[model samples]
Target: MVEIKEKGEFRYIDEGEGDVMVLLHGLFGALSNWEGVIKNFSSGHRVIIPMLPIYTMPLKKAGMDGLADFVERFVETMKLDNMILVGNSLGGHVGLIYTLKNESKVSRLVLTGSSGLFENSMGGSFPKRGSYEYIQERVEYTFYKPETATKELVDEVFETTKSIPKCLRIVAIAKSAQRHNMAKDITNIQIPTLLIWGLNDTITPPLVAHEFHRLIPNSKMRFIDKCCHAPMMEHPEKFNRILENWLENEAHKAA
Candidate 1:
């Protein structure tokens, strides 16, 4: 069973037991993005999915550094030690930044379709009041297989984007990403790292993953063919299998 708990300004889903695995979601996403893989992961490890403050409930205007600071506080608040941080998109970026600052606290790192290393080609212009068609187009852009952009998914995202406040929040996040550059600091990360990418990801693309692999000395990269930005959602089974194997290898080495 997944138990929801609120700690200060953040809300998180806590489930299972053993060494901690904290999953972070990207922009326009919540803990549910990991729903497909969470059960499998939770069976063997404690899974904690925290709702990022800026994304969910912004206390103030924050850039990447501010958001990274929030993640640090969340870790301290949860008393998490030697965590395996798995993040997608914005979440992955935050995880990378946090791990760079607090290397000893992270046992391993997993980044999937992460941002922050390079400037996004998808410019920062967002509609003030997005229509269903507009929202659908944006959602469809994330997927290489257009069929994966189901009506339900598009509608869900559309509802969220309809809110003016949410739109503004998204703008804030885009600006933060534009100002921060993690590529220069990625080499400083000393923890075991894994980079997962969807082979057809147009948003971040496979080249971004290659750069991450090159920068992090002790890192490995895996690509899911015919997949797009959200592989954890689009190809959970394969994604989970890769993750399970990597985690097992890391554990063996540690043992």
Candidate 2:
């Protein structure tokens, strides 16, 4: 069963037991983005998916640093220690920043199609409102298979951008991302890390993942063919298999 908890403006889902695994979603996403993977892993491990307020709260100012600070506070509030951190896109960037500052509290790190290492390939422009075509175009950019941009997904995203407050928040986060660069410090990350990328990801692309693997002293990189930015959603079974194997290996080493 999934239990919802709130602390100030932050909300998260906590489920299952044993070692904890915290999943963080990217910009314009909530904890629901990881529902499938969360359910799959909850049977064996404690899974916590936090809804980052950067996207949901009506804030006058927001930045990567602020988001990382929120994660730090969340960890402290939950009394989590040596837990696993898995994040995608902006969430991945926040996870990296958080792990760097609180290395002793994290046992491992997993990043997929994450941003922050370099400038975005999608340019710095925010999605335009009142244009479904533009919204569809932005959504399609994240996928290798354009057909995967189903009607339901496109409509949901289109509706999301229609809200003026949400649009402003999105723009704030995007600008923050453009200014944030952690390439110089990635090498300083000493914890075991896993870098997963989709071979066809155009947003961050596979090249960024390669760079992350090279920078992090103790890290492994894996790529999924014909997949795009959201591999855990586009190719969930394969993604889960890879994650399960990695977790099993870590367990064996610990024993």
Candidate 3:
């Protein structure tokens, strides 16, 4: 298990040491979501995962902009610069907003199964509270392979939804994502972006990836076969290889 640190108002995992690489997770995302990424990249990169204040944020400030604001504060507090941001699902949406607002700080961006364009999130609704089997079914729907939704992962999401306040926060954020469309603002991105999408992703779908590539100039995309929403988890080796090669090529070009 990754050790989560609490300092001031932040709780996150800080590991390795090199150029900074920040990892952001989506709604219902847990530390385990990025376990493969942390292990593979931590050897040569400083990996930081800030536990997004999804459950704790005041319901009024629980939207996309609010989460980006939190990231800004976290970045400032950490005194980080020239960051390489890797985000998945809802985290990708927040990263996009942050990149647009703070372009200089971000040297590169990686998005997978992002939600800013279009997503099939069951009408942007969470499962019925206290229904374990229903929650399991919903979680399984995210992946092409039903077994990808492990018992632990399902239980984690289950426990999270058990709280009424967290449920409210999740609903508000989902609605905010639906309302805040980035089609107009994404064209403003000025840095190199890498989009790694799951070919079988039910949430964002392949068309969404194509749309992102079409909108963002200087962006490249790679699709992993049979992969669903969370490629990093479903196909960690393939995901890592794509990311590693992309990062290396980008660095060489920068040099």
Candidate 4:
């Protein structure tokens, strides 16, 4: 647990060493969300987990800053170069934005249940299907097993929601719902990219993955069974295997 707040109010956790792998969590999520997958990933890669600035605040309004700029500063401040960016859900959106802006810094990109994508050309507006109830519905769609959406899961997500102040939550939600055409930027990105989706995820849905696979030139898509918005958490073993295999393939290709 390495803490460095030199860059705003963010602390970075460093684990393992080799190729740098930066992990960013989704909305209502902090760095801790990666606790389950980090150990498996750390054996062969340096993992840098950052606590997002927006979520770190208690009652402050989420800023209007674009995801790309935030990532640029975060990477520059950390001095991380030639790294892979892995993001889940909202984190995926951040990773995509960052990669689009700083292509040279990323060796590869992987997104699990990422959110910065849409099926139609309309790139703005908060998800009408974003409320807690809507989130539950979306979760049902993203996970193949309905049992996964148990009361415990609901409570866990509710707790996560409560962790953030209402003001920041509203702002973050609003920013996400609003429009911005990141797809155009992704289309020009030539870096290696991987899109992982939970076949059951209704929030972003598999169609969102299809959109990314369609736009991003060098990209591939994989679906995790019985998982929803977070395959890395719900199905860590499968997630790790796929991630390692992809990394290995990337290494061989680079060599």
Best by lDDT: 3
**Residues 96-151, model 1: lDDT tens digits:** 88998999999999999999776353333464465777777777888878888888
Clashing pairs in 4: 123-179, 124-178, 124-179, 125-177, 125-178, 125-179, 126-177, 141-200, 142-200, 142-201
Candidate 3 residue pairs in clash (backbone atoms < 3 Å): none
Instruction: Give the Cα RMSD of candidate 2.
Output: 1.9
Candidate 4, 142-245: lDDT as tens digits: 35676656656655555554543543554564465345447767888888999878887756778888998999999989998767677877788888888888
The Cα RMSD of model 3 versus the native structure comes to 1.0
CA shift of 87, model 3, Å: 0.6
Candidate 3 per-residue lDDT over residues 1-255, each given as its tens digit: 779998788999998999899999998887789999999999999999999999999899999999999999999999999999999999999999999999999999999999898988743466589999988988998887999999998999899889998899988898898888899999989799999999999899999999999999989999999999999999999999999999999999989
Question: Which of the numbered candidates is closest to the native, going by highest TM-score?
Answer: 3
Rank all candidate structures by their TM-score, best first, as comma-separated numbers.
3, 1, 2, 4
User: Between the candidate structures 1 and 4, which one is better when assessed by TM-score?
Assistant: 1
lDDT of each residue in 108-182, candidate 2, tens digit only: 999998987864644336788999988888787787888877878889878988888877888888788877888
* Deviating ranges (above 4 Å) for candidate 3: 122-124
lDDT of 4: 0.70
| True lDDT of residue 50, candidate 3 | 95
Clashes of each: 0, 0, 0, 10
The ten-residue window of minimal lDDT in model 1 covers: 119-128
